[model samples]
Target: MQRFTARAVVVGDRAGTVVPDAVLDVDDGEIRWVGPAADAAPAPDAETVDLPGVLLPGLVNTHSHAPMVLFRGQAEGLPLDRWLGEVIWPREARLTGDDVEVAMTAASAEMLRNGVTTSVEMYFSPERIAAAVTATGARAVIATPLIPLPGMPPLEEQLQHSVELAAGTPTGGTVEYGLGPHAAYTLPLSILTSAAAAAREHNLLLHLHVAETATEGDELLARHGLSVPTLLAAHDVLGGRVLAAHCVHMDDADLELWQEYDVAVAHCPASNAKLASGVMRLREMLDRGIRVGLGTDGPASNDGLDLLADARLAAQLARLREADPTALTAAEAFWLATGAAADAIGRPDLGRLTRGRQADLVHVDTRDLRFEPVGDKEDLLTHLVWSGITPLVRDTWVAGRQVVRDGVCTTVDAEALRADVAERAARLAHGG
Candidate 1:
């Protein structure tokens, strides 16, 4: 057993408790106890480590295309359709399994060093991505992209492969598998329904894009005589566990359908804003009791995989859209990147620092000038969300194992991975 005492521990519980001089006890990769240090009783054999900083639940990135780090900053300033069809897809066709592993390795290290331990990834080459996740000691829920394009396998074949992958996922590992049908505009009704059915059969989350752009919803409405959400519901595609990403163009009716289907939203505010996509109705979504989590999207689009930055952007965008500073509080925004994100992805054991939960946490060094004059709990939370603290993540722990220490990733050689990705990214960019 190991015991860690920190200056302050942000519980990230149901009540969003913050305890000063907190002690957290971990055994077998699970939290055994969490409370004030004055009340903690140390076991004879417990190894105690005292840290100087505030401890927080490791950030949960609800949506990402980790392998797309290879394509980061390639199609800058383009709309979503042109960006994907004209720039991304053509280059992605040349991606090999080894390229994906290299890109994901860099991405995993970057996220871990930035205090994100759990991520929901949607990409191709699931096995390689899973291998990269394991190598980096980062927990991930990987969804194999089921988009049927030229040079790609057939939809049925991919669906079957996804099922096999999900079934073959090792038990109690740091990775899980799911089915990802690209989106309504990219896939047919039959493909979407088939993916949903497969997800139900395998008991996997159906992760996909939904109502991302006005053009996507308009095209779906013109073709199907229904909105994207309604069409999905009519075809029984939303009947199972679903994580819809980039729900920026949804309406009241779409929100109603999502609520009825119990679908969670992965709000990628940074990517949306960068692509000139409209802001999501976050205030309305939360008011309607919808589950909303922060996502960094893909590095190719968002240009970074920092969930803390995304949380601040989400809150700012929500307030700007609603014209109310009180639309989303800092604590609430922080929750979107932590506990609420885990809940959105259907993992209750993650994203919180409490007993019986997975001991995935981060320690941020507050001695920096960014956190100067840190006051009470509310002030600290505000500083964390509003101030730039990404570089202050001194350490990150996932499942009771230290993946990052002193702002450096221990599970992977970051410099070597970056050097490898640079060559691959250049080749992919030049169409070599």
Candidate 2:
């Protein structure tokens, strides 16, 4: 058992600063108590911490490539199509399992240091990624990449591996398993059918990149004579409660298809804007009451795995999309990153500071350069979303364990991870 207290904590919305000096007790990897410090009875056997910051629920990243940390800043300034065909896929074809482990380890560490507790990742060699997640103590929904490129093996090989990893790790892990079928044009109809069937049997979420760019949408329509959603629905893969990465190029029909089939969207604004894929009418999705969550896409695409930064960028982009300063408020963006995202991903108990939920939380210091002049709780939240510079995340906890403290990675040798990334980059640079 362990116990701690935050001087001031944000308990979701409308319950601002409920616990001025709040106590949080963790027992056997669960939060047993969370209330005022004066009301909490002392547990003599428990280790105690005194958090000198504002405590809030940890952020949930809906979509990312955790191993792409190795490729961060290496691929940039190109649209999603050229970026993938020219830079990403070529390097991806050469990566080994060991390379994946090193990269995911460093990525997971960076995510934890910035207060992200759960990640939904899709990439190659996810077994190595699962191992890194296990060692890092972060939660993740890890999906195997099913690229339909030439010389690639059949889906069954990766299918077997994904099943094995999922069965082995459900909880107490850095990641579990899910289905990732790359995208529409890349994966044939037969492969989509197989993935959909596997997803149904396994009861896992199928994550795919669809309508990410106008060119992709145009090509798919030219070849198949159907929109991305229509083609997938015909193949019996669009529905079944899946996570679609980008709906930027989607039409009213495609949007209506999501409403009928109940699909969640992972809006990656930074990635979309950086690649000039065009904004995906984020406000339009919200207005339709569609399930929308924030995603950093991949570190290579976004240049980092910082969820707060993503939330802030999401807010800014929403305002840009609507041409209104108050398009997406700070609290609303916060919900998108936290509770809304958790609910979108089927984790209702997550993204809120309450009893019986997963003991995943972040502590942010208000005494920082970015958070000065915090007048009200809403203002504090505004700072969190709009002005959180350099991460006030002094500590990050996942499943009742302090995985990162004082902005340092507890489970990983940060310096060694840095060196390992350098080595991988060198080897890949020289084609060794």
Candidate 3:
């Protein structure tokens, strides 16, 4: 058992609770107790560690392709279509399993240093991705992507592989498994239905991209006279544990469908702006009682794995879209990356620092100049959302294990990983 005393603990509940002078006790990778320091029970057999800063729940990335770190900054200034068709897919065709493992290891370390303890990953080579997550001592929900790329196995085979992976990986572990259908337009309606059915049978998450660009669903609408959401609903693909990413082009009926079906959205504000994909209806989604969480999308699209930066951008865009200063509050933004993100991905055991939850927490150095003038607990949350504190994350723990200390990852050699990725990325970029 371990006991951590902090100046303040951000409980990361829906109410934005903050306890000053708090103590948190961990046992067997789970939070045994958390409360004000004065109210904590005495623990004679626990190791004590005092943190001189604020303790908060580790940020959760609701959606991402971490191994895409290999393509970061490689296809800039291109729209989503050209970006994937011209550069990303072509280069991804050359990826080896070892390359995926190395890239994911480095990316996982980067995420951990940024105070992100868990992410929902959708990419190829699930085994390699899981290996990287284990190596870094981070948590991940791996959704094996089912895409119809050239020279790949049949769609049926891809679905079977995802099922097997999910069946083998037990529920409630550091690594969860899911099925990721690329998109509605990318696959046949039959395959989407089958995949959703399989995911439900295995009690796994069904993640996919949807309505990212204004024209992304044009072909489907022209062919079936229905929007992506409507088509999905008609085919019974919207009812499962579905997580739709980049819902920037949804309308009233589409939003209603999401609420009715209880589908969650992975709102990637940074990547949407970077690719000119437009902004999601964040205010509308929240007002309509839809579950929405912030995501970094992928290293290539977001260009980084900093979830706090995305929270800031999400607030800014919501305000700009609604033309109101209070369109989205700082507390709401922060929740999207923490508690709300966990709910969006159906992982209730993560993203909170309460009793019975996993002990995934981050230490934020309040000595930084940007955190000054915190007059109250709400003010502290405001600073966290708007003041760019990603670099101020001094330490991080995942599942009661300290993975990052003093802003450096403790589980892997970051320098060597960076060098290895550079060489591999160069080869991939040049097609050597």
What TM-score, computed on C-alpha atoms, does each candidate reach? 0.98, 0.93, 0.99
Whole-model lDDT values for every prediction: 0.90, 0.80, 0.93
Give a tens-digit lDDT track for model 2, residues 230-267. 98899888666588997888788888888888899998
RMSD of 1: 1.0
Candidate 1 residue-wise lDDT, 202-255, digit = tens: 789899999788888777788778988999999989966799999998879999
Model 3 agreement with the true structure over 330-420: per-residue lDDT tens digits: 8888889999999999988888889999999999989878988888867778898899988999999998999999999999999999999
| Model 2 accuracy (lDDT, Cα) | 0.80
- Which sections of candidate 3 miss by over 4 Å? none
Task: For residue 391, give model 2's deviation from the true position in Å.
Answer: 2.7
Better of 2 and 3 by TM-score: 3
